[model samples]
Target chain A: MNHYIDVRTQIPRARQTINNNNIKTETEGGVPEWAIIELQGLIQMKKEDQSGPTVVGDLHYFSRNRHPVLILGHHVLNGKEVKLEQPMAVIEKDDTTSYKVKAIVKKKLLFKSRPKPIISNVSEKV
Target chain B: MDTCPERSSEDVRKIIKTAKLHESELTEVTQILRFPDPSKQNDNLKLMLLDDNLLKEIEGGNQLIFKGDPDENAVLCTSSKTYDIKEAETSNSLLLVPELLFAASTGLDETIVNKSVEGDSDSSFDKSNTSLNKSADSDDGKPPREIVHKDIISTFFTYYELKPCKPRLSKLIKLLDPTKYRGPELEYAVDKSKLYNYEALFDQIQASKAELDEELIKIQAIKIDDHYRLLEFDYEFRVLSHMLDLIEENSWPLDRISKDVTIDSLKDLVPESILEAMFGFYSSESAVDDGIQYYQYKQDKVCQFLARVLLKSAGKFNLTEFLQAWRDSVPEGMTTDESLLSGIALIDKTTTPQVVWGFAESDLPEDINQRFKVLFQTKAKWTVDEISPYIQLYATEKLNVNALLTKYARASTQDGVRVFSAKHMK
Candidate 1:
């Protein structure tokens, strides 16, 4: 039996599927910024079967940006590389959904430190 | 209270001292973190966009300014560019925590903590922290600008974006999952080995197949030979039976028997060695010699068989009756005289003589005298010319006996010729 959920109610699951499929993102929500993107726009895919641009719904995309690229001859992010622009569709908290916008790939000269990875469940021996 | 900043001015100073970043490096670090409303900052900017996530270097030394989130992921960024959080805690950029919000929480906390706990003054900590924040946050008052320096920009984008070049799909697929793309690689490895093992195996199989085929052919040939030999034996038996039948049906004359009974003429009846074994009457001195001994051996066998056949048919034989019978038996193409003589010669040693001549000088003389005595009794005296006809009557062939005639007769001159009369006293 196929249990299908409305995409509106299933954004997190949808996002999980996209992340598992290895699409790139630069957004905090872990989604790209475009309504339709060339399937080739995702770094992980070879050329997908369809020739024209694919709507964000058709794409396997996520805001999780672990996709890798070679930049100035170095592997970054635990030997992973990321591409910043890919198409994504995200459902907001109120169930309103937004498609990705076209983003110009530009240099972010003012780089900030990543937040420390925190382990949550340990107690102090007071 | 929810957005608590955990860093202190003393920690920031420590990072600066470890990295040896100059005052300008400190300013760049401070500016990037001090966007009054941190929540409103661009998401792309907040990404750890540099390879080492170090944004810039201060001029005097190895000090580099790095950026990362400190509390959310606990990356613990430091000014030392090569530091990894999982590997070591020492980093020069550790002080530049984005969560610190260089102006509000961490700065004030450092001032209060310094005054209460240690000999360090609140006034001195406030001076450095406030100066760094003022220079950094005052740059736009509008929004934090994207970095403009080429080296800094290039490093950030290189880490964050894919280059605009195509990569080979086959190579890319292999790189993605090596285990699945195994066919070509396995074949290539097998080909590169020097043994040519598959070819060798094929050759061995072919050789074994050829040997089996040869063995099958040999067996077939042996079977054919055995079959042919049996057929030949059967044919010989048939031919011998036919020859024996031909002999029994015909009253073969002596010469006809002689011609037909030779080993060469009757070869179809039986092999030469089998014929010799059956009817041979003489032993040859040398088996190797196709010479006179072998010829005589064959001739003797033929004559013996004929004599035995003739003797069997008629119980007892006399010369006159045998002569008549042999004359009738002579085959065409041979003279009657020659056939009779050869037959007599063959049977002579085995048979008794027919004519008796007692007290004879020789058979020819005794024969002549006997004929004269009989003629003389018929006529008391006769001319020599009258005796010629009677003398020829007993002679089997022409004989010269004119000189012997004087023993039986007396001669006188009468008219112009001579006449002879038998002497009465002798």
Candidate 2:
């Protein structure tokens, strides 16, 4: 059994700026506001994992206190490309749950830009 | 004018000091006080005027000198000529004590001085009524009257922080001026009662300016605009200067510049970028986010903003004391506490045990550990199967019900039934 879930958290990003010909670094921005991170994917529970309520063949979503596992929206990935409605990380709950499941997206739609017209009339016709 | 029997040289000097008489005016008044009247040939006049020669000589300068002077005579003397002593005494003007000068100069009645000096108990009410009548009678559309600088300062011990503020001084002039201090007709008329108090106010302003001059000598003044300027490189000065501009632009009177004035009210007057900079100047982003938005603003911005306003408006308010009071009175992290408490209360009141236990079982083990022990505990012991519904029903996240129960309660096996008791100690 597989289930879908959403996880939201904050991700730290390095922002750079130049001050008086010197590079300045900052951990946080000048003003603080809420940041929402979204993750969506199919989760399959491990058979041996017994910490929480997951049973074998059951899929679940997970969020953690402190880890930035993946930022998987439109950016390139190695090995196999699995397309998701939103970015998600493959959470290996335990060694038994780790399976060599390959996800190859036929078409990567998240990073897809606006498609150009097939034909264009150059004449200035209203 | 009745001859002042108790008048001494010290008394004469005090009048000079209080009125701030010039050198020549001093000479003239001295001669008048020291000389005896020659016009009165009576024995009483002879006894009073011990020095008849000096009296004759002073009588030569002006015919206004009286044989009998009032106990404390405050003569209004212009540079060229003195107003008739008889005329001054007979006029509706209040006796000019150094403190009363501002009141007289501003065209405000002496009643305020009387009210201030004598407690507002009873007599002042009558005096105020008379003052109102006087103001009504004297309501000619003229500019506020001028007074000497010495008259504006009060004799009491007080200090003004922003005394020499040019913008404030100009605004004050406008506020006191009968022609410019426009308001509702009733208010305008009522304020006119203080016309006699203008001289005292002017004296205060002048004293403030003098103090400001002394203070300015130690600091640098940077002109920021046509009407505004910075007096020091310090952050306090910067904030104060900006605050003064806001008060002036808004026409907030000294009494109206209170701490209750909201930061939102200043939104249009002060830019958000400056507020952000000021906030950043003292606090970090995370510190601000850890509290409620409004509480953050008050804790961070209230002092700098209020100090400036109070200094400009009331000419007082110690910054440290104000801040300490604010901290002591306001609870820390109240907003966060309120939010957490409300959330817990809502859930506890509306939700069932099964739902709460499921949430606890799934992702909030710690929360359940804290709340469930207090909420579900009773004298009777509950079996594992009896409590299983609460832990498993509506639970989406994977959780071990048996293992989690051991964390908060004591489990015992009796007659094939495993029972859990919250009060059972390990």
Candidate 3:
């Protein structure tokens, strides 16, 4: 319980290794690479399928749109790129000295809207 | 395709140059998101969610730490504040995509590859061949080269949320009890553990650095030979009395007491460092003259110390006798108010002699329920204002003093004044 959540060494180093990350412009840079795909309900799958490499969905990014679209099986759900109101620090407690910040996630890929069914309407050639 | 990238948060991308439709630039990239292999899905990653204010402090480069005992729930600490760390569970899967591309990171540059291949995602199928990419034309109508794939390294279903709370500092007193500095002369007599320095105390005490520093000041703890040492009660009272005597001997007005003057006079009597810190405790800075800042001996602080000194010696005294003695003990021209005794001493009229006894708040448990038990044990009943200081430390945004009283103590009007007594009185 007497532990430290060390961010001093991690956060300052993350700033220089920036990959298109811009936080508050004046404050600091963004965290590179990491994001959370926060689904509304549980991404429940069958027990048998859970053991294998399961396909969650396909994320489609379109130019000029604020949010992206995700295709899961027969369902097409629009996902928004949102900054989490309270940013979270991903902590990894290794079996030794202290807890370290693995990554800090500022923005998330939010898939909250009701999924629209991808109804195929292609006309068959005779 | 088998590599897990150079960095932990790397976003690996791959592109397929499928046949292109002329004139329409289909820059859209469809990425297949999948779960990692079941063996790789370890719930080792925990998110310590930060509030906006605390987030700002973190960004400002403050150290965040957590402290607790084995059975107690751990508390997190920033430089200035402490917070209760509560694990919140989410029904939805928190797909921790360390390299998931945000809207801003996915443009112009080829830092990311063709989006069909998920870098950390599951390799159950050939992602490049299943080109959901029907059209493959750049803005220049050129077919792009290749594709890439990546897997999610980890995922989590719960996160640690923080709520600001009073620093749990009662343990500090317990830790320092054995190592009390009874002056340099008596240091060899008692067997003690290797003394706790600031760093050691910080590691042991369940409080933030700034909060802990303030508590040390309030506890009047002084540094002797780099170790934060609490002065023994008798020794501390001796020092306090000497400091008071120096003020009277020099004929210096309370407002004009100089650090240089106190240091020069008390150097042989008390260590200079102890003298300086004690002055800081009993006084507040008023103004600077000739580059020497003067401190007015704080009236309330001095009076409280003197009252504690009187209350401790007598253990318990008839209310009238204790009041007179307390008044006589303080420096002349300074007055003592009963309100100053809020957390220091309690005057009980229920007793036959109506005695006033020392009851320092620092000795009580930091817990809400346990503290109420001790309060009720000390005296059967307490008026609202009398017990507020003792209980007020636990008051948070969701639970204020009145609300806490409602839950823990039964209330009734005693002689037109609201009084609180333990709910299940023994």
Candidate 4:
């Protein structure tokens, strides 16, 4: 059977590119180039993406400590374009729980000014 | 007119013999015959007459000897008229001679006159010479002067007055020489004793003796434990007991309390833990329960009594009016939902009397009159939470701990949400 897995937990690799006739990995520090590219793509997507209908999905993974973590339902992703409505959950495999986490979402509105009408009747009436 | 004949003849014979004698013999006879009482014609005069006759015979003066005896006892002489013979008795012969002389010559009376003239001549010569000498010396030109008896007496008195009666300063200095005073110490002491009153000097000595006695008494009065004993109990057990009541009434937090709380501050509201600590430490017993029991049962009654006393001493004012007025003036930041909720949370957690006291002393309006104005502000209504930080900042700067506590207590009560209309909130 084909089993589904969370891509967040998978180790990612940098893509090699030719620059000045030399091939080199694009990553800096220990972070993967694909993750940085994805974050930048997401930042750009939020600025340009219009409000529209889209499909949603869920993902699950384990932390380095083998903690049971759950991604909440209904996240929109279109390659570079992604939006989240709720926070992901992290549950340790231990017997006791010490604290809980809550989610927060904020939306800002921008309004445009309408053009004023020309006073063509003023001179004729006067 | 009735002349005696025998006196006259005898006088003639004496003059004839005086004329016959030499000057030297005459002088010798006159000296011998001179009588103190020549007026008596006695037998002594007959002897003088015989000496005069002998002197005349020796000097070779003629002596006509009368041979006719007028009487067998009397000597006789010739008279001018006749050779008269008279028998004169020797007893009465001396008296009859002067009578015979007076009858013989009228010049015999002139002889007494001549004797007075000779006597006055020498005295008059002395008087004139003395007067001439005095006149030549007289400067006043009035007359020859004699010393008046009164002037001589006055001059003697003047000389006595001018005579020195007392010694001079130099003489007194010589008598009291410093070199002599240093010679014998006893003499110096005697002289000094004379200069000062002995009774007063003795009194001074006695006063110094009394002072020494007083000093000894003061030394004896000093006790052994006086130095550090009082310092040991300077803060009494009762002081801690009083502090315990104050801690409970104000709800002071346990962790915040320290022994460093000034006696002046703790006097207002005594803490129970302080009393428990003091009693436990001093009495060597666990006094925690005793302190709690004392506070829970008896301390409240004591505090009420103290509060009544303090209230009586406090100034009179309409508390209702003051509270209402303060409520009205609460700042805008104090009456918001967020500030009010936060204030309530702070008040619930607060354990210290200082925090509660701070709220009680805020200056914000408490009346409903200004409530509408407070509700209109967007930031928040003025409440203790908003004003307290400022009061703490000010009170801390002023270093007034009492004011901080009072303001903290007042502010806690004043914290409340001010509900506003939707239009006003915007």
Candidate 5:
């Protein structure tokens, strides 16, 4: 009837992962921490019936720039690196009370602007 | 591009090689050729608001817990703070990208590539376009381009946002009702399971362990035989009244009351631990003389308890008479003020004799509307000062006492004093 979620147990595991000198990023031992890709509204799949796997869009960066561009069909979405007002920690609820932090994402990839069509695709090709 | 869909394929892009341009469509950006992960990760996943304090707690390896009964809403807790967990919905969809490099990481030396490059931009085109070899120019730039190989793991539309809240401890009072500590002799008659220890109560109550412990002490709950239990009011009054008599009989100054002496005298009435806990509850350390801790009896606390004992059975007392009896009832050198009676009792100034009634705030209904309804029913109108304490318990960080009143009650100025009444006068 009552429950208490324990986040303490995950701390030691997180520390253990950090202590392993060779492993720089989230490796196979743990659930890789997820960064948020915030898109305005929902990802409306064109084929609502396609079952196996859905490829929503193609995410890209022009040349070597840090700005991210997502191409959905012919529409291109231009989004910038927005620092999160408060850093977000992705917690995966395990069993009952055990919650583990996968990663703390300091920023998010926000695509709120209207998706512009690929007019730059042909024009920008070098 | 295929007419059926431009992209629908297995996401086996974990191997490190070089980038491959897909289709005749020309673009210069490095593509993150990815697919939805077949394994579902959204069902059990939930996002939490992390402030700096909470971030430090997670990093410091302190215990953070979420507590709730099956019927009650959940609350999150750190070692010393209690917070309400509210599932806030967002209009935007947040996609979960596991092991995806951030903007800061774009400059890093190591990068993962999807396919290999063998020649210049023109010679690298593979004519046969299956799912595997959908490639054109591989080496468009100097360094072999890196394409991210990862799953769009999940998406979130809502998150559990936390705001600091008072521990919902009214639930504890209910749970310990059946297991009141009458005395040591009747210990076996009481169900030990019902009298929950800290861990057990922690599971049942929507509160942090520290807050729970504080409330237990506030209500004079003492751990008897390993389980925390509230003392029966009548029995508590009896022991406290006896303890009060010792103050006059011994003529000990309030500040110099000895802990050892008090416990030694009351040891026969109840367990020494219970007396010690009560002493700690009613007194604060004033000084330590030769290692013996001297405490000042809390005037406000003692007066309030004494007044409750007087008012509990009397129900209603003439304002002047009640004040007189309360003053006489309290111990020497301790002053009793009307302000101390804020939540416990109310004076009906509108009445001819102005009778005072015992109306404990905790005993009132928890719901906001119901609480207002009862308050208005008891008295047709209440001044802002009179109504605030009763209603402030329902106030949250997002909504304060004023906001709560604006939503639920009708306010009007009477004799230049703003008074609150039920919204619907009928």
Candidate 6:
């Protein structure tokens, strides 16, 4: 059977474990601190008769306390971007050293490109 | 007989003074004897002095008597001697024995007593007289009023005089009494035929009530439906009328006649396809002596065909609501390709109306027309990859893509496509 890895769950778990002790740092002075964690997860897509597993996508992560955080790069990765069927999260053990992820894998479908939002001219004050 | 004729004056004076002293002592004794209890002494004295009975007792004494008739003569006997009595008499010849003196004094006392008795009788008579006078004063020609002992008594008498005496429950007893002829004869006569048809009358009333209720319910439902329909129609009419008006004014030809048979004249003709595409764009562009008119003419033709094809689709949906939303999305002074695209996207998201995609250039806003022209050229080559981003942007921003698509598609075929050829192709 083919086993699928939930990229959303793996990304947050890796970030949480890395930022457990280290304080967030910022690139510019006077700017609020932000935490960035690069997560790489190997998602496998196995065929029914194939003996080996095929990698689907890699997971990348970055976060800030406030502001719009970009989760995925604009470019496609291997003909696909890391997308999840459902929102997922990582669960940490009481000892805080290890992590376990919980996720659901639903039926996969072709991903449509996110449309570029049009910028409309703001209407003049009447 | 009377040998010793008279005593000396000095001896008579001495005798009178001694007798007077005895009389005072006897008077004191009589007062004491009258009442043994000293507390009642005043009462006893008043009785002896003032009472006629005491005087009468004194009159019965042997020393006092009437000489002739009792009623005519008043005399006193003194030691068996008689002396006349008068109102004013002062004479030594009237001297008498001490017992006779006391008795003669009693005679005067009796007269005083009799006068006192008469005075009392007069006083009592005055009291009775005053009472009688009061009774006579109270009589004012009206009947004597009797005091009522109880309020019920007065009320009963008043009710008796004012109204006929009858039992309070007479009517009720008459209604229930078996002795009285309280059967149908005494009751209001009901028609037997009407009573026999009671069930039919009841059925008729029930049927009428049911019909009334149903009619009321229908009226209420119709009122509500009409209210919503009016609102919907109002919005529909506003948008549809506005679109038609704008198209007719800006898009249609003003010339009444086609002057020349030229390629330019062909351009002036409105495309039938575009006309039939939607109800709102029918009069947008006018036929003119220009190449754009040919596109308009062709568009009219295409629109006509689309109208037939989409009649069922439009019927199933509220085209009025869709048009209103489309018109509202296109803001004022936003006569641009991007604006039109945004309006189309809005309509698509809200109304989800089906449309064909392309571009056009006419006597519309210059920048938007040019953009459409550019996009049309690119779309002709089926290079959607280059235009997909713009389309995506238009879609995401909720522009009226349907209008843009129809307008642009007509503009691209304006040069070569003929209405007759397009009709055959469809």
- Best candidate (score: TM-score): 5
Best by DockQ: 3
Which candidate, 1 or 6, would have the higher TM-score against the true structure? 1
Residue-wise C-alpha lDDT for candidate 5, range B236-281, written one tens digit per residue: 8877787777888788888888878888988998788878777877
lDDT of 4 by residue, B1-426 (tens): 012111222232223122221111110011001111212212211111112332222123222122111122111111111111122222111101111111112222234336437773322323423543242232233221111110000000000001111111121112223212111223334344223222222222212223323432322211111210110121332453454544555564432233334334653443333333343332221124424422122322223222222223234324333333323333211121213222111121232321211122212233322422332232233443443442342343354533543432322223455322212323
Instruction: Give the worst 10-residue stretch by lDDT in candidate 6 chain B.
Output: B152-161
TM-score of chain A of each: 0.16, 0.15, 0.62, 0.15, 0.61, 0.19
Show model 5 residue runs off by greater than 4 Å: A1-33, A40-58, A63-65, A71-76, A113-126, B1-31, B36-43, B88-92, B107-144, B287-291, B349-354, B397-403
lDDT of 3 by residue, B113-200 (tens): 4333446221112432343453221222323322223456666667787888878887778878788888778989756566888988
lDDT for each residue of candidate 6 in B1-426, tens digit (9 for 90 to 100)? 011122232332222122221111111111000001223212100000102321222222211111222223222222222223222211111100011111122223344346448763322323333544243332333132211110000000000001111111112222222222112233254223222122222122212223323432322111121110011222223333343344344543423212222222222332222123223222234454445332222333223222322232332434454344434433233222323332122112233564323222221233544555554433343223233334332332234544444444432333464211111111
Position B124, candidate 2: lDDT: 38
What TM-score would you give candidate 3 relative to the actual structure? 0.73
Measured on C-alpha atoms, candidate 1 has an lDDT of 0.28
lDDT of 4 at B18: 26
Best by lDDT: 5
DockQ of 4: 0.00
lDDT of 5 at A36: 80
DockQ of 6: 0.00
How much is B84 displaced in model 4, in angstroms? Answer: 99
Off-target runs (Cα >4 Å) in candidate 3 are A1-30, A39-57, A61-83, A93-95, A111-126, B1-27, B34-44, B57-62, B102-148, B192-194, B256-258, B285-296, B313-316, B349-354, B377-380, B424-426
**Residue B387 accuracy (lDDT) in model 5:** 81
